[model samples]
Target: MTITEYIQQRRMALAEQLLMTTQLEIKEVAIAVGYTSHSRFSSLF
Candidate 1:
């Protein structure tokens, strides 16, 4: 995979972990994964 795809994969994985293990809001999780736009993060997730 391209570097960009790899990074996105990693971020999405981390986002999934956070969602499963923590009570953070979706927006907060998105920001933690380097996404500024909630809609974009949601779309990817």
Candidate 2:
């Protein structure tokens, strides 16, 4: 897959893991997943 698709898959995996394992806020999760904006992360995750 291309870089965008790879990043997207990683974002999704991280989103699920974060949501399941921690109480971190969405924005924090976005940053942890290498994104600067929650809205952009939302679209990808």
Candidate 3:
């Protein structure tokens, strides 16, 4: 996959984990997924 596709897949996987396994805030999850902004992550997720 392209880097964009790879990152997107990872982001989705992170989103699922964030939704399923923890109480961490969205901003933290976004950063972990390599996005600096939760809004950007929210848009994609």
Task: Kindly list the per-residue Cα lDDT of model 3 for residues 1-45, writing each as its tens digit.
Answer: 899899799888977888689887888888877888889889988
lDDT of 2: 0.87
List clash counts for every candidate, in order. 0, 0, 0
Which is the winner by lDDT between candidate 1 and candidate 3? 1
Tens-place lDDT per residue, model 1, 1-45, is 999999999999999999999999999999999999989999999
Off by more than 4 A, model 1 = none
State the weakest 10-residue window (summed lDDT) of model 2.
7-16
RMSD in Å for candidate 1, one decimal?
Answer: 0.3
* Tens-digit per-residue lDDT, 1-45, candidate 2: 999888789778978899789999998898888889999988866
Per-model TM values vs. the true structure? 0.97, 0.78, 0.76
Report per-prediction Cα RMSD to one decimal. Answer: 0.3, 1.3, 1.4
Model number with the top TM-score:
1
Q: Each model's C-alpha lDDT?
A: 0.98, 0.87, 0.85
lDDT (Cα, 0-100) at 1 in candidate 1: 100
lDDT at 23 for candidate 3?
Answer: 86
